[model samples]
Target: MKSNKATIHDIAAKLNITASTVSRALNDNPRISDETKKKVLKVAKQINYQPNHIASALRSGKSRLIGVIVPTANRNFFSSVIRGIEDHANILNYKIIISQSYDEYAKEVLNTEALINARVDGIIASLGKMTENFDHFHKVLDKGIPLVLFDRTADVLDVSHVILDDHLGAYQAVDHLIKNGCRRIVHFTSAQRINIYRERKRGYEDALKANGLEVDPALILYSNMQLEDGRRLTEETLQNKVHFDGIFSSSDYAAMGALQVLKENGIAVPGQVKLVGFGNEPFTSFSDPTITTVDQRSISMGKITAEMFFEILNNKGAELISKKTIIKPELIIRDSSK
Candidate 1:
């Protein structure tokens, strides 16, 4: 059976020219006249021509494709980061392949292997919560591929990364609550050993001490920082008679959950219990009482992460001396914290 797929040879025959000339025209070789290039492109569209990216990569030793891995894409933060990366990728004529880890270690490892097999020019990734072994990422470096980690990164991994000042962001949130007369505040945070959460917890404690408030272990609640976790923690606090005048959560979803529970129990926000959250998620603004949160500067983080990847690639790994870039966080004030 004969295939109907159009090739450069078919285009050449249609234009009464050699295949080499058609190829050069398609490649926009300076020697090929603009008139010829335009004609070739018109014919290509008419015939539904597709360029062989694999063949081009084989010839040029560059796939011109970037692979990105995220814990999950459902959040606004990760999506915005992807948009920032796309902004630069469009101008550089590079294609991006995005994979979601769903915060599973096995899934993350599989995604990394798959990307490596795809021969991507480079990879940008955020470590999954369950990931403890860095061998999969090490394989990428072992194969001479560039890997750039963003947001949730590991300090042990001797690689380039872009992150926000989690400590400062958390400190700002706690400080804001304290200034608002939240003398006995409840903190919801993650129990994971992840640096971001650890730093955030540190900031929370530091802010309390700075304001001459005692750091009460009973006020600290550890969980996955999900909506259910927040609700359960808040409920337990209410039931156990823990005296808390405010709630500061490390996740917006968690904070929203706490708010719902508080309102259900007839607790007035800012009047009885002030609230603050992190991750400036969209719903924080439109809630009945707006939420005060910290902006992670995700877009800027993404742009810087992509730029660092390119730098490593262009410099042939010379810039991979474990350079880390930290973006500042902004504290967004709203009704919840007022």
Candidate 2:
């Protein structure tokens, strides 16, 4: 009642049971009778008793927690993935701690170190945009924490990854444009440092080449994938007389910006310039002209990423399973593309 803290001893004293018995009941030990466990749980809840996770970790050598790092939680894709992780991890009796990197490499490093210090049994992460150096993850490996990289991954790292096939997704977007008789196409991309972007860029090029169109270096512009970047590039290309009948953007947000600029300049969406984008963001469909884009199956990706973590954990660190799971993306047709 004084409210310093509620402990198991308090619950035991109130219930007139041994602290060990209370502990067992709290843990749902099969040896404890259901009636006793129910009573103990009821009293514990009344007293607002909190378990000593640190002590439990010391006893079992595990925190029964998983650390998750995402580029940005504000984005729908990452948030959906986190939801999937929570749903699956909850079934496994594991709690989760989430951290956002904000697409910064330095912040990612710091967040990971903090997660390791928390004694998390495993980590599920989507690497930041500029994480060229994966030494921090290797440190996670050195500490024997099972790590699974999802969405964005490092090819050089010897870890399991769940990723969408960005190349094929990009090819599909571009090929769809080609099918609609879009000859000259402009590709707006960002963060070429990340493998996903690089793969998407490659797909855009190969699709153009396969369709007997020359890969135009001048048409491809890399930016920060921000709304302003999309607007600026599209505006500049229009002013520079870059004849582009179609525009393919790597992000839906940017595509939305480009769409605005196209409307301001009296350009028809599918009639004059068919447009496509990546990442099936919610705004894609809600926009004036629904955006034709690629769906990365983010929920399924998150589910499998968590499953991969359990796979490594079930092995009990005897072997680091370096498996790669790639999901092929699906193209969603909408009003913006014919």
Candidate 3:
């Protein structure tokens, strides 16, 4: 029950013209008259003639495709970043192939190999949570393909990277809390596995030390950046009588968890315990007391990443310079941190 594939020969036969003439017309050849070209195109459309992408790619030596890898496509931040990349790629006549690694190192390796086999002209990647190795990325560099890193990037790779200014964002958040008469502040963060988290923690510590406040080891809580983990940590803090006046969480979801637990324990926000979080996720603004956080400028980062890739592709003589572009994060003040 399969339908036969239509070809240029079918159009040529119907028009009583040669296949070469049909090919030239379809290609918009100057020698072919407009009337003949229009007629050939109309017949081709009627017959549902389709061009082979593989054949065209082989002939031109350009796939006009870009590959993007992210930790999780389901997250709001990553999805927005993908949208930004797609918008820019579409304007430049390029298509994107997206892959998710699920924050696993092995899956990241597999995804990189698949993209290489597909022969993508460029790659944009945000490192997964468990990705600590850079061997897979070197394969793209070995092939002379342009690679751009965004968000969570590899410290070892010497490539173009676009990321938010994590340290300053954290500094501003903590500084604001201090100005609002919050002392004995606590930092709830993850393991120092990535630059963003590490830098944010450092910023928090530095702010406390600068303000002549004692940096209590018991107050710094380390947990997986998850809602359940946040809730568990908050509950533990209450059980142990930690006496924390303020908290700075590295994730909005975690902050939400902390808020719920504190409310259930009859603790007032901003009145008893002020809080701030990172990554101004959508839910931050809609929470009971709107959460204060940092905006990562994800869309602009994606556009700049696409722009960097095309710049390398267009430059014929000059070698592309590997550089890092840091986009500063903006602190969004809300009622939660008041």
TM-score of each: 0.94, 0.97, 0.89
Pairs that collide in candidate 1 are: none
- Steric collisions counted per model: 0, 0, 0
Q: What is the lDDT of candidate 3?
A: 0.86
- In model 3, the Cα lDDT at residue 179 comes to 87
lDDT of 3 by residue, 214-271 (tens): 7788988888778887788999999998888888998888888998998999899978
What is candidate 2's TM-score against the reference?
Answer: 0.97
* Local distance difference test values of all predictions, in order: 0.91, 0.91, 0.86
Highest TM-score, which number? Answer: 2
| Shift of residue 151 alpha carbon in model 1, Å | 0.8
Order the candidates by TM-score, highest first.
2, 1, 3
Residue 316 in candidate 1 has what lDDT? 85
The residue-by-residue lDDT of candidate 2 on 1-338, one tens digit each, is 58679888898899898999998998899999999999998998898888877688877888899999998999888998998889999998999999999889999999999998888888999999878899999999888888999988988888899999999999999999999999999999877778888999999999999999999899999898878988999999999998999999999878988999999999999889999989999999998789999999999998999998998888974856589999999999999988
Displacement of residue 308 (Cα, Å) in model 1 is: 1.5
Which pairs of residues collide in model 3? Answer: none
